[model samples]
Target: ANRLLKALFLVKYVDTFKATPRNLTVLVYDRFGLDLTGLGKQVQEALNLLEAQSYVQRNGNVYEYLTNEEQEIEKEIKAVDVDSAEVSSKLFRYLSSDILKTNKLKYAKNGQDFSFGYKLDDVPQGNQRELTIHFITPETSYSDSEIAAQSMGRDELRVFLGRDKRLLADLRLLLKTERYTKQRTNSGATPSMQAILQSKQVLNADREKELIERLRQAVGKAQLIINAAEIPSSSQDAVTRVSDGFQELVSRTHTNLGLLGGKVYPEQQVAGAVQSETGLFDAATLSALNSPGTEMESWIITQTGLGEKVTIKKIVDRFETKPYGWDLGSIEVVLGWLVGNGKVALSVDSNPVVRTEVTDLIRNTGKHPHVVVAPQKAYDHAKVAAFKKFCTDFFDEGAVPSDPTELARFGKDKLAARRDELNALVSSSRYPFVSQLAGVVALLDEVVGKQVDWYLTDFNKADELLEAKEDLIDPIKSFLNGQQAKIFDETQALLNTNAGNLGYLPTGSADTVKALLADANAFRGNKMNQLKTAADTLRGQIDDIVTDKRAEVTAAIDDRRAEILGSTYYANATPAAQESAIRRIDSILARLGGETQAALILQTGATFEQDDYPELLSRLVEAQQGGDDDAPPPKPMVSVKSISVPDASGVLESQADVDTYLAKYRAALVATLNDGKRITL
Candidate 1:
């Protein structure tokens, strides 16, 4: 199970979206092509095991691989130590340099190998595992410092990559090329577009036969190369940008070819027009008929005069603009107006009642069936100009709507209304500028969405600060401690004074006894009242301190944030640089959280040790306290003789053999763990 799970771990590294369970299943099938007779069930079981072991998190169908955290925890849990107490302490000190979480420390022991492990998690992944220090004892006859140096040297490669610029550059270039090749292969870019189309073309019988044949030959000979551009995965935004560019190209090509093919081929000029015969029209009475092109006159003659019987489709094709036709519904309204105005007579004998104009309508076509009929109707290019202006104005104002959802809703509504207009404009080969409009609108939507998200995040942070509840632990602790000390002293003095007075008083005198009791009662009552008043004042002061500290922390966070935001470098950064800046800001926020948590701990009178910060501890001890930067590095405290994994293969042939081997392994592990000694100052 572990082996299979390890094999499946590659899914985590793939450049796929989300790595959901369904996608994971698909990936396994595609890559391995294993007989999936019942593999889905096996996959589910595997996922269940991983989740149970806390190696991954499955939220709904989405799976987030948690290999890093899992390995880190595993190292911490399995850390074992053996040998003398003095040696163990030195080993722990060595391990402490590696691990961050001091509280994750554990003690264990095993035979021969006296080792201590610590989980290091400075990087994103748990690339750095346990840093173990093996002790050399008299029994083992090994050297201590040698093992320690060996352990540290094991991570030399990683350290070198981080420090050596030239080496890292070479490594990065190699990785980039390898990733590009992998992505190119995975995307199936070679001949993929051609395969996707599968020889499908929009050219029909209406197209020019010779031109269509030529286009077919051209497309067949065309060698398409959909290159998967090399981009660094380290820069996810750049990768996404390249991916989006390819996607946009695919979408634009689809739109152009699918809807505007006929328009592109002039021989099939009316090919883009929809053949709808349902619309009813009367051409005689509408005001549009008188506007231009003898549009109404052409329609009236076609339906009822010397023209042959015509369908709505034919009438629209003849009278309306060519190539891309106008809306059929709008044309119907004009025809209805003509009939109502009694400028044409309707003949009811036809399925579409034929209309005859009051005066005979004639078109001067001369001898040619294909003559220049009417000058192409001029469009208000000014509307396009106005649209551009509107876009510029809208962005320039930069005034956000009160409700975040409102802007989204408005954009959605407007896009829906304009969808037909957009599709029609694009379908007309003449209106190539529509692509620019589409690009602008898409960009606007994306920017607005990002802005909204940013605003909401800011508001949420402010709300959290306002509503947070924190303890005034320092003030309260101080108050209680001071009062307890004072009360103890006063009680001692009262007891002493009473004892002395009692000795001097006459036991037989009733008046004297009564006076003494009254004095004692007065003293007790006065002290109790004073204590109550002091307690109340101290409580109020604690509350005030809590409020003030909250204000102070809030102000500090805000000021630091403002400084970062106001930096000239930040202001001038490109989009990618801005993203990198945001990541740095996230690091700052993490530091702030840690600082606030430490402050709260100190306030509660809990010990907040400087040793908790390994980096800071190094600065304090090694750099500042140790005198100079050029000072010699610290020598290893322990050394390793050999590191080995026990072989169980020969003993695993029989159950008896397995049990015996396990028993010995368990005994060694238990001893190592239990015999671990804590480091003391």
Candidate 2:
């Protein structure tokens, strides 16, 4: 026990640290060169004695030397004969428990040998269990290189060589196993050890050059996988060697290995340097690992084929798992590319999403969005081209759009603008013929404005509808060109004719024009014919009015002439008197003929009145017959004294009585004047 304790303290002193259980065990074997056969019981006895005396404290499998009597212990260890067979066997047993406790291996003592196997629960199945046995012989050396080399030959070796060369070798073995497991799982066929090691030997690199060369080969393999998956060239840096001599492969490609999945593990530790397995770059395992964009497209197509209504959340969930494990940002970028290219259709709350809006929609979790394959019709090149041509021809300011989203924008922004323009044109006061279009304006509103508006939320449907409704352009053009233009010309012609003939249209004819302008259907279909007939009728009415006015004026002139010629005043007159009266009547008739139809009618009544032209003609005749042209006519005096007062106050009690009184007064005054007699009021 003193010898073993001195060895423990010596190891700590030599290594300048506390001795771990494995360290103590390794030191005993190196120093004494002991036969490790049948040593477990003797090693337990030494530990039990040292622990009872408090010379050492046991922490897990490590014996920590605790004695203050270091000098005495060292002196006793120096005096003892550690080379004796019995003492050697006891020294062997003294620290064998350390190695035994450090592992889950079951040991059995033979005559001159110890056999180690896995504990029952830890044992591999069938023949693998037989390969797990570790034999420590008299010639065995407990060194890292030896243990690492030994562990490589056994497939079922499960020992953990903690912080030792064997740990690195085991880690390499673990990487190999992971690669093999992934290959077997993917291809369902076991890869030979020779094949796995042919690229680079396993647990064989002892120098920096070999390790660096291995790292380069690993990177090359990872690049092949990345290339096969069609990952962007920028992602080639996913596996790269840093300045620190460690190769780190980023785990962007999520794949499952038995022990290395979704984690950063040290693949091999050499010369204080570590190689980390940050990703799975095995091509066979990553055979299903496609580029994010391509994988997402395939997923959507497959889901659609399965009759599944795939949501954005569902896609995020799918890609965020094994095999295609992608970050949310990566998923969004790929999804946007697919949608922008018209490969897939995206919608939020049943409203279609355009390419530019996909990123925001994906980021906003509150919006539940669905994805599916875009309809072929929405992107049909022939249909899209035809529709673009239609838009270019129909709209005055139209521009050809490239995709469904741009087309939707055109319909909303451009087509809507055009519709408003048409509406303004029809409703404008400058184009009074717009009233002749009947349902043309309404039709434009429906097709150009409201129909496009209805599909604004759905870019694909909007694109499809715009393509299918190209026929509406021609009819709208025809209405503006044929019916509206023709009616304007015809109506203006009629108004000009009326202005030339009668100076102004009559009140009834003006009202007819107003009604035609007011009725929206007045010039629609057969109504257009009716408008022409109404215009013709208006023209005819003006002509008739002019004719009747002229005839009336003619009659007035004839009657005045007859009055002067047939009267005794003109018959007994001199020829000069007759000529003078005839000249005066002809001058009045000529003045009436030059006036407008309305003015002529007004002047006809006045010109033929006895107090007007006829009175003037009579006076002219009298003057020509030797009568005084300026003689004052006899005046009859109106005297109130000669009239008797009718009780006007009594009769003027009401408005009717007052009116009757006024009528009598007027009659009496007129009668007095006619009789050439004096009358009293």
How many clashing pairs per prediction, in order?
14, 3
Residue pairs clashing in model 2 are 43-93, 43-94, 643-680
Query: What TM-score does candidate 2 reach?
Result: 0.35
Tens digit of per-residue lDDT, candidate 2, span 1-681: 776789766654354654554455455565454665434445667766886665764432456565464333323322333233332232223222322332222111111111223321122322232223222222234444554444442322222212323222323333343344344346643354234333222222322234333323333223111111222233322122110011011222233211122222121211011001123233432222234446677778778778888887888678655454444544554555455545666665555655456555655655644443333224455555655555565454454555654565465566566556656665774444454333444554555544332333322333433432343334444546786558756776667545655454555665565476556544345655666677778767876777677787688668756765776656766787677767777777777776655555655655456345435444544544555757755343334334433544553578888788878777766666678653322
Q: Cα deviation in Å at residue 471, candidate 1?
A: 99
Off by over 4 Å in 2: 1-48, 52-292, 368-379, 392-401, 405-432, 442-681
**What shift in Å separates residue 492 of candidate 1 from its native position after superposition?**
99
Question: How high is each candidate's TM-score?
Answer: 0.13, 0.35
lDDT against the true structure, per candidate, is 0.34, 0.46
Clashes of 2: 3
